[model samples]
Target: MNNKTSSFLWNFRQLKLNICPFGSTSIRRLMKVDPLKLHKSKITYQSNSLQKPQSSVRNFCQGVLAFQLEGNEIQKRSLSTLTSTSVGKLLNPRPLSFDSQCFLMSNTTPQLAEDGLKKITDSVEHDLSPKEKQLDFGKQRDLIQQCNSMSDVLDVFSKYPRFSCCNYFITMWKIAKNMSEDQKRVERQLLYEHPAFKQLCDHVMKEAKIVRLQQLMFTLYAVIRIGIPQNIYLVQVLLRVVQERINECDETSLSVLSRTLETMEESKNVDALRAALRLLVDKQIWTIEHILTLQTMMKCIGKDAPYPLKKKMELKALKELNKFSHVNSQYMFGALAALNHRSLILLNECSKMVVANIHGCPFWMLMNILQSCRKLQYQNLDLFTAIGDYVTTTFDMWKMKQVLAFLFAFETLRFRHIGLMNMFLKRVLDESQSLNQKEILCILHIYSSLNHFHECKNQEFLEVITSALNTYLPKISSLNLLKAVYCFCLLKHFPQDPFNQLLQENIINELLMSGNESSKAENMLHQVNACLEFEDTSVLQSIPITLKECSSDSFFSNVEVEDVLLNLFENKRLFLKNVQLPHNYFVDFELRMDSKRSQVFPVSEADVFVAKPDILRVALLCVPRSAFCFGTTHPRGGLGMKMRHLKALGFHVILVHTWEIKRLDMNPAVTFLKTQIFSQEAFPTATEFAA
Candidate 1:
């Protein structure tokens, strides 16, 4: 009870310790007893009520060892087991018949290989769940339908996950080889209507998930092979989607955007191209280095290709360029300059077509081209000449006026050509014939800016201007008299000598008459003064008489006739009596006669003659009042007294009264006394005055 039980317990504890290090007691339990023999012994013991299992346990242990050895041999033959024996040890110990080892290795190899291959095949074949299989088939059919609806169904299929990658590409290649029109149409419609197509595009773009490049190539091929139309709306939507996708900072999105740009270029869908360019500019997606490519695209789009479409494309290109606010103006300007040069070339090329199809090319088109050139600061002299020639030759007078106005407004003043100025003047003069004073006024302003006022005097030019002025002046309301005055001033300076005569007789006198009570009179006076500088005294002499009749103090007030008087005195040593002088003399003097009455002597002989009281006032004010009558009136009859004093002083007086005054006051006593005071020959006859 003590030694034997203790020994058994000690052995069992040692065995438990051995198995404990192996991390499990199952091996220890197997070593302790055979479970099959124990089960059989237990069955016998249960039947006989006794335990007798020693022999059975031995046999069971032997059987278990044999089974384990066989399993080890099988594992080694299949090459699926790792052994602790070294390679040298295993080679020397594992001595078997060559045929037996080869046969065993061969038998195990096929079964392992088959099992591995079957597992892979089964995994591939059963990858989709029941629900996924249905979904995949449905998606495949949907993609096929989409491809059939559109001629370019590959664009949609390549965008679908179920059809994208290897699947869509292989299918697209097959469809491309055997494509029918109906099939192509159905594919295209399917693509056009597929919602997942856009989603797939967005996913590839946003996630940068380019699982395959072949799909893209096939999609592009299909688009081109099917011949994409110039559908602006479709292009716009595509461009917007591209823009949104490109904003995601992904390689796939950029690749897609770039590919779209290239496709747009090939299609010559300039509107789409411009739309892409505008997106680039608006998004500022490209770095400054990439702008060169953008600019090149812009140039290609703006080239003159055809009619409304070309114009539409060009305008869109210009608008896109205008969006680059921070772009280097010099770069943009250079690009625009190149574009302008091309435009001019195009204009020349199409000019003949425009002329032939006159109704097709409206004046606005030419005007817009010219305006664009100007706005871009494109100043080519040859282009300007061509434009000028076109305008002058093709446009009527009214339209010519608009063209000239644009030229005058926008063309550089420093570049004003003399020939252009001359042509403009001639056109203006001709066109202005039917124009009202206001319009004429504008023409005059342009002439003035060109400094062409003196040019009107050119005989040929004068005829046109005079005709225009004469025709339009009467119809113009008095409110526009100031403008007429400017025109008159231009006419006054024309180079023709006869213009001077006409001015003196007609224009100047009429202007002076019209200016009598109008505020415009002062301006007219200025013009009259300008003429006086030319020393055209015919008008000057008429001015004094006109002033005498008008009784306008202000009129006399403004006229600087002292200079004229001095000029006349210096030139002719002559002065007029009883004629108005401009107010404000720089010098004043009194003349005295030696007598008991102390009469003021005349400063000059011309100051002593008189014709009427108003004229007398105008002329006598140049000298002191004592020189003529101090406080005398017409009834006082100072003429006789003055003549007697003059006769006593040994002077001759001219009886210069008007015929009306002479006929009324002719008394023989008074006449004889006036004759004694002055010689009869001193008085001129009315016939001489008329002459």
Candidate 2:
């Protein structure tokens, strides 16, 4: 009998390995079989004369078998080390042969050891009480695999205690749902509404004390993926379990738990998030997955990580960066960008890796890498050019928003790629119908920023936008509608007919609702444009003179003069007298332009003279280029030609330097004007006029 039990368990070990790779470990630990002792035992049958001597060995084998079959807590405690004691050492081993191996592998179900082994397995299962039978991990795992409905799965859960097969059942549920068809998935969707599901949830919540750490993590992750709303009680229990076992979790387990918590959107849970953070902060190195999870956690907390933690993460990332495929690198770069990490060296290294792997990279990943570079303001011309070149080739493959998002990235970083812009415009024109209101507004914003309004020369693009306006304007949000109106004004063009009416109506209401004096002034300009389009001056009397001051100033006599004065008054702090030159150099001896007349002066095809405003005595010249760029060739072209003449006429030539625009605050011109208006120091000499 001892020999029979030893041979049976050995065969069962082989079968268990074949059944489940993970289950084999539990089987080995549970059986406590000594391979060396089994190998030394000689095969023998019970002889009639020696039956009396072998009764104890038979009784020992029967006692162990009975204990395993019952698997009750009391019996388990009593026979804790029974297999490791002298009882297990009495096992009899048999020699292995090809015939026996074939039989064990192929004929495992029935007639195993010629009915003797079958009797042992049958007796072990059939003789157990119903409650003890639920401890059978193998049978429960099988039932979970074969589950066809939510009720079937819930039934399995009901049979076992909360912790017994929670992990395995949840995993199997995910696999079934993910692998099922739409109809089958709909069938499984019933799980969320099932009463049994609520019962199971309540069970876990009430009995969370019995759960293990891995089981808790797995259960939470499964819940998140299934799109169930988590119970607050369950979440509290999970966090408590994590707090208690924080020291016992290894790096891999910690990474998984943090990622699971993030999926749960519980990163804002102060206690739980900090517990995971403390464990991960000290690690010197990490796998690529851990690097991804660590950065995600950093983003969730939305604070700068400690110096040591950040340095270690960068070091680990640098070492493993080369080994990551493009997808993983996308995750890495995006997470780093999300955390607002500013490691230039690692960014440069990642750029090189991305460029090298550009062929297989998807548009979204490429966009992510570019967006990261834009956010960090990390400039790598080679990296940008590589991605730009790829985008050029694959331009047609991207969707409308993707193309626009890609363009916006470049626009924000001030990296101009003209060819890519052309491709993007062509795609947008072709796919305009697919665009939504938000997308159209975005495209317009991008185009306006790039000064690509000239590309709107395409009649097809114009027609598409014109067509979309009717459908899009009413639905666009207020902020974006304001932006769209601004784009139209910036382009100095509006769409045709009914679309234009819709746009104008929205714009008028938005501007009036703004309550800003400038917004009312802006509305006057739109009205002026409408009146001028019809060549109707009958309505000009209704236009307020103060509103006329905000109109676009243009000098037909001096083409560059219009832009300078327009930029000067753009700050809206001080009013300016628009300067006009004579149509023929001999027609007017002096340049004198009135503010009200200059408002409509740019509309004339021929140059005209107008009187100066009473408040203007100074001439402000805007030099768009830096003084350094005024070389010998173009010396007298921009500011040099105008500076001397204006100063000779006794006007203070206050030059607005366009090259210093970035360094200037919101109202540098305003500040300069205020200083000039109050200061006792006289206007600077002509030598200082080139400022």
Highest lDDT scorer: 2
> Which one is best on TM-score?
2
Query: What stretches of model 1 exceed 4 Å from their correct place?
Result: 1-366, 369-380, 389-433, 436-439, 453-457, 470-484, 487-691
Tell me the alpha-carbon RMSD of every candidate: 35.7, 20.3
Off by over 4 Å in 2: 1-138, 148-152, 159-163, 172-189, 202-212, 266-270, 283-304, 319-325, 453-460, 470-482, 496-510, 514-691
Candidate 1 versus truth, CA RMSD in Å, comes to 35.7
lDDT of 1 at 543: 36
Worst 10 residues of 1 by lDDT: 59-68
- C-alpha lDDT of residue 484 in model 2: 63
lDDT of 1 by residue, 131-234 (tens): 64565645775666556333244465444444333344334545655777776676655654555444443333221223334344334334334444323222
Q: After superposition, how far is residue 325 of candidate 1 from its true place, in Å?
A: 24
lDDT of 1: 0.38
